[model samples]
Target: MLLVEDEDSLREILREFFENRGYEVIAVRSGEEALEVISNKKFQIGLFDLKLPGMDGIELARRARENDPDMLVLIMTGYPSEESVKKAAESGVYDYIVKPFRLEELEKIIEQVTKEWRMSRENRRLRKKLADLEGEIW
Candidate 1:
């Protein structure tokens, strides 16, 4: 998991929370830092704060997807705006999470998304294996 949040306390809290839940989390303070990490590592899920010091969540999500289309992105915003929400959708963000939310709510969302992500990964692997087998038969 890749976590990008500007708030120090919230970042630490979320990092510890997910880590305790058996997730290997890479938490960063800014989108730039996240991008640096993203280039080297592939994360199945990314939780990004909507507002960042440089490169907002929407842009980061879009760019991250360009690097890894299978990466699922969730945007977290304390100040939610209609325009921003629409932009997030346009950027292919998987979900938008309003801040000051219950941890359980986030956990539920993560669980569901994780399940779907795993399924998709398995599907892709199967498809590739099928293609390889067909090639061998031919």
Candidate 2:
């Protein structure tokens, strides 16, 4: 996973937290850098700060989804407002949370999304195998 935030303190803390939890966290300070890293690498999820230096989190989410429609994005913001929430929801983000968010809550969201992704993939594989077997028998 990749984390995008400009705040040095928060960025460091979250990096340590997720890394300790067994994620190979690539933490970036700006949205532009985040996009560069993501475009080259394969990441299971993204945690983006809403008020990024080069690009806002909402726009980042939009572009990332365009590049990868199944990308699971969780947007974070210290600034809270109805308009921001509305815009984020419209962009097809997996989830968004206002900051001062709990690490536990973030972990939970990440875990659930990862689990769902795995389950869906496994189900698809099983269905494909079943179809192949039935065709061979017929």
Candidate 3:
């Protein structure tokens, strides 16, 4: 998992929280740092704070998708606006999580997102296989 948050306190808290749960998290303070990591590593899920210093979470999510189309993006925001919602939708984020959220709720959402990621991966694999078979048949 790739976690991007500007606030140092929340970043450390979330990093420890997710790490304790057995996730090998690459936590960063800014979207620029996140982009650097995303270029090298492929993450199944990306949890980004909507408000970042340089490149906001929405733009980060969009760029992350360009790098890893299969990555599942979840945005964390303290303040949600219609503009943010529209941007999230445009960015192809899996969901937006409100800050001050219960850890339990986040755990559940992570579980669901992981499941969705696996299913999407499997579907892509199956589609490729079917296409290959069709090519051979023709």
Candidate 4:
């Protein structure tokens, strides 16, 4: 998982929270840094702040998805606007979370995303296995 938040305290809290829950989280302070990390590693999920110093979350999500289409991205914003929400959806974000949110709420969202991600992964694996078996039979 990749977590991008500009606020130092919030970033630390979120990183610790996810880490304690057994997520291998790479936390960064900017979209630029997140992009750099994404270039080197593939993440199953990404949590990005909508506002950042450079390359806002929607753009970051778009670029990240270009690298890994299967990645699920959730955007967090203190200032939620209809325009931002529309843009986030257009970028294929899995969800948009408003700030001042409860940690439990975030956890529930993560759990749901994880379930879907696992199901999708399993489906792909099964398809590959079936294809290989068919090739063998032929």
- Badly placed stretches (over 4 Å) of model 3 are none
Can you write out model 1's per-residue Cα lDDT over 1-138, one digit (the tens) per residue? 999999999999999999999999999999999999999999999999999998999999999999999999999999999999999999999999998899889999999989999999999999999999999999
lDDT of 2 by residue, 41-110 (tens): 8676888899989789989988887877667888999898899888898987778888888999888998
What tens-digit string does per-residue lDDT give for candidate 3 at 13-96? 889998999999999999999999998899999999999998899999999999999999999999999999999999999999
Candidate 1 Cα misplacement greater than 4 A, ranges: none
Candidate 2's displacement at residue 46, Å, is 0.5
| Alpha-carbon deviation at 13 in model 1, angstroms | 0.7
What is the C-alpha local distance difference test score of candidate 3? 0.94
Model 1 residue 40 CA deviation in Å: 1.0
Residue-pair clashes per candidate: 0, 0, 0, 0
What lDDT does the true structure give each of the candidates? 0.96, 0.87, 0.94, 0.96
Ranking by TM-score: 3, 1, 4, 2
Question: What TM-score does each of the candidates earn?
Answer: 0.95, 0.86, 0.96, 0.94
- The residue pairs that clash in candidate 3, if any, are none
Clashing pairs in 2: none
Error of 1 at 58 (Å): 0.5
RMSD of 1: 1.1
